[model samples]
Structures are given as structure tokens and as C-alpha cells.
Target: MISWQARALNLFLKQTVKRSIENTKDVNKLRFQMRALDKFVFGTSSNIERSQSMREGTLCDEIKLKFSNSKKKLLYVHGGAFVFKTPAIHNNFIARLAEPLDLHAIVPDYPLAPEYPFPAALDSCYVIYKSLLDAGTLPEDIIIAGDSAGGNIALSLLLRARRNGLPMPNCCVLISPVADMTQSGLSSVENRYSDALFSLDVMLYCRNLYLEGANHDLHNEEISPLFADFTGLPPFMFHAGSTELMRDDSTRLAEFMQAHGVETHLQVWREMPHVFPLFEQLPESKAALQQIVDFIKKQQN
Candidate 1:
């Protein structure tokens, strides 16, 4: 059974949010709405200490620099079906990563649909990642992390980095990534009613907007990293809400990573939705945060 919070979330979805699911139809309006959310979501601080600034014309969320020990830099990507959300909207979420790891983080707003499209989001993120290397960040101090679409981006960035001979991050963490964009995964359909937040139709709609003309088949591995080659990734840790739609993405990806000789850890939180650890204001969210903090600490060793 879904929790009371989940039930209320679903009701909100059916009423107000369900309507916006159709935001795919008007890309401009969608961007406008996202801009409004960015005020609260993008520009929001990672709440960490460090020199901070915002850079735009890149991707979805404006870039943010959260200070830390100054030497260690963690790069973060925020997920919104590759359509909605920015760095600020995910500040509370990304900031938690900083809290546990005590590392500086750079989150760039990658490009989104219709206006920017697939290669747009992908390329923009790649650029910022490459910038880190150009700026002389050591491979060991760099950790890549993301939730949902950001998770997918994090994986994609790892693959691209490896393939291009850029130093792979020392580790990566994904929170409920969308690995099989084709939506062909059994969980994509089976877990539909399970996750309190995501709807398959809504995901399909967002996928449609992203891959509209490009790969019609999101399972192509470029859009979804499940089929991508992750042969030489760094150490990793991931968490998934058992009832969440993207749980399998984390599990399956972990299996693949381990199979490929990458040290990996996977945590499954029962009856929760995608990245519930991020909702730290709530009870479950607090417990979830502590677990992730522990995981990151382990990797620190």
C-alpha cells in the first residue's frame, strides 16, 4: 500500500500536475514554467561552503558552484525527464551530497527538449564535465552524481568520459536513474502503479519530447545507458525506493557495473519512490539521507 504522503502526491498529480504532463506540447511554455521553478530550484544553494556562481546558455539548470575543501569537486546533474527542473529545484537534493561527502560540487544546467533536445542536454553536460578537467581538477577528487534524469546523465557522462579518454570520476552515484529510455524494461511498466511520483505515460511524453525526431527508440543506449558500455567506470553507490518506477535501473546498472569489474553498492528502500532520500524534511527522507551519507563516507575511505 502507498503511504499517506504517496496517496496525497498521487492526488495532486491527478489534479494539477497531470494536466502539465502535457507540457510536452508547448516547449516554450514548458521552458517558461521551468524558469519559474528555477528561481526556487536552480539558484538555491547547495548550502555548502565554497565560491559559488551561475553560468547559463548551457543546459536545463543554471550552473552552481558549492564550496568545500576547495580541492575536492563533485559534479552533479539534476533530473527532470530531461525536460523540467534546474539546479536550484534540486539544491536541497544536491546539497545533501555535499553534506555527507564534505566535497565541493559543480552542478550545471544542461539543455532540455524541443529547444535543445537530446544531444543538446547530453553535449552540454559533456562540455561542463570536460571543463572540470580543463580547469585541472584531479580525477580522484571528482565524483559524479545525479538523481532521476540526472542519474541517467551521470552514467552517460561516465561512459562518454571513458570513451573519450577523459579521466573517469573516482566514483559515481545514481538515484533512480532511467537506464532504459525505450521504456521497454518490465519495471517501466510493472512498477508504474508502484512509484508515487512518476507515471509511465508522463515519462513516455517526456521521452517523446526529448527523442522526438532523433532515436524514436529511446532504448538506443545513448538516451538510456543500460545498453551502453560501462566496462571501466569508477567505484559507485546507488539507492532506489523499492516501489519506485526506476528501481530496476539502479539494480540492473549495479549488476552490470559489478559484472564489468566496477566496485558498486546498491541500497533498496522498500515502499518508497525515486530518490526519497532527497525529501529530507520528512521522516523517511531523513533516514534515507543518513544511509546515503554512510555510503558516501565508505567511498571516502
Candidate 2:
């Protein structure tokens, strides 16, 4: 059964956030509104400590437990349809993960869309990964993670790393990833109304802005890792709401990866909002966070 909190949050998002997304046409305006909303919802203070540092010339917010001695790292890419940077909610989510899992989390403030599209974000993430390896960080000690558009970057980064013969990370975690840019997934149509956070129009708008001047179409492997070869990718844990417009992005991609002999786990929460774990108020969010922590721990062993 879905928790009451989850149900109430869904309604709230549908009525407020989703409506705002649908009504806003300009990307800059939408970004500004989202920033303000994130601040309002998540607030500015957090228990976890955050510091700024540069990796491969990319500025990143490094998060971890105080006095942490761990060598493992989590490279988290924030999702904003590839147009916005890290928001308060994402910061809190990363903090939550880093605290329990004892990981040194590095979230790169990568370039966004319409200005620096396509290969720009992917290239920045790849360089950070390489920097980790160069600094004597073992591939087995690192885990790459992201949500929504950031998930696209995290997965595509692995695909690119594999092609270049770089050792894969310990594993990957994706929360409601926008894996398929083509938006051809069945849920994209069937869940048009059920999805509380995203509408079909908003998804297409973001996709168009991200792919604006790129030579590749929506089907490009880098743009849509769902269609790419997953031959030697690392184990993956995917979380998505059953009602999400991109539900099949996680489901289909997981099935494909499993078929390729990659260890893949996909969890679909009934009637949950997209990236529901980002909402700390929901009971289901706590359960999902525990599952993610367990998944990462298991990968380590």
C-alpha cells in the first residue's frame, strides 16, 4: 500500500509543481522558478558538511561524513533535464546517502543544455571519472550515481568509459533516469496523466533544448543510453515510480542490461512520484533509501 504521505505529495506535485512546469515555456524562467521552489521546500541548512573542489577543471561539491577516512567515492550527477545544476533536494539526498554509506560524494556542477549541450555534460563527467582513477582511486572503490537527466550522464559516462577500455566502477545507481531520449517508451504515453511530476510536453521540451544544435538525433547512443550496447557495464540498481512517464526507461534498460549479462536490479514503486526518494517526508522514501544503502553495501562485498 502506498503511504498517505506519498499520496498527498503526489497530489501536491500534480496540482502545483506539474502545473508550473506545463505553464512555463522559457527554460530560464522554469530554472529560476525551480531554484526558488527547491529553496523553499528543502531549505538551506544541512547536517552534512559540504566543500567545493575541482576535479579535471570541473567544480564539484564534495560531501561526506565529518572526519571520514574512506577511500571510496560516489560521483553524483544532478538532474535538471540537463539544464539546471544541483538543487537543495539533490544536495540533501546525496548527504543522506553519503552519511550512512560512508562515501566521499563528489557532485560535479556540469555544464547545462542549450548553451553547452550533448557531449559537453558527458565529457565533463568522464573527465572526473578519469581524474579519480588518476589519483590512485581504485575502480572497485568508486560507484557512480545520478537521478533523472543526471542518470543519463552517469550511464552514458560508463558506456563511454567502456568503449575507451577504462575499468568500470563498482556499480551504478539510477533514480528515475531519463534513459530514453526518443520518449518512445510505452509509459511515456500510457502514464501521461498518472505521472505527477513530469508531463509529456515538458519532457519533449527539455529534450529539444538539450539536443538543439547537436549533430546527433534523439537516437544517438550518447543521447539515449537505452539504445546503446551494455555489454560490459557495471552492475546497476534502478528505482522508478510505476506511474512515472519514464518508468520503462528504467525497466527496459535493466532488462536489456541483464540480457547482456550485466547484474541489474530494477524496483518500481506503486503510485510513487518521480524520484520519490528525494522527498524525505514520504515513508516510502525512507524504505527506498535503505534499499539503496543495502545495494551499495552488497556491491562492496
Predicted model with the maximum TM-score: 2
- Model 1 spans with C-alpha error above 4 angstroms: 1-69, 216-219
* Candidate 2 segments whose C-alpha is farther than 4 A from its true place: 40-47, 213-215
Candidate 2 lDDT by residue in tens digits, 143-164: 9999999999999999889888
User: How big is the positional error of residue 168 in model 1, measured in Å on the Cα after superposition?
Assistant: 1.4
Model 2 / residue 236 / CA error / Å: 0.5
C-alpha lDDT score of every prediction, in listed order:
0.70, 0.88
What is the number of residue pairs that collide in model 2? 0
Each candidate's number of clashing pairs is 13, 0
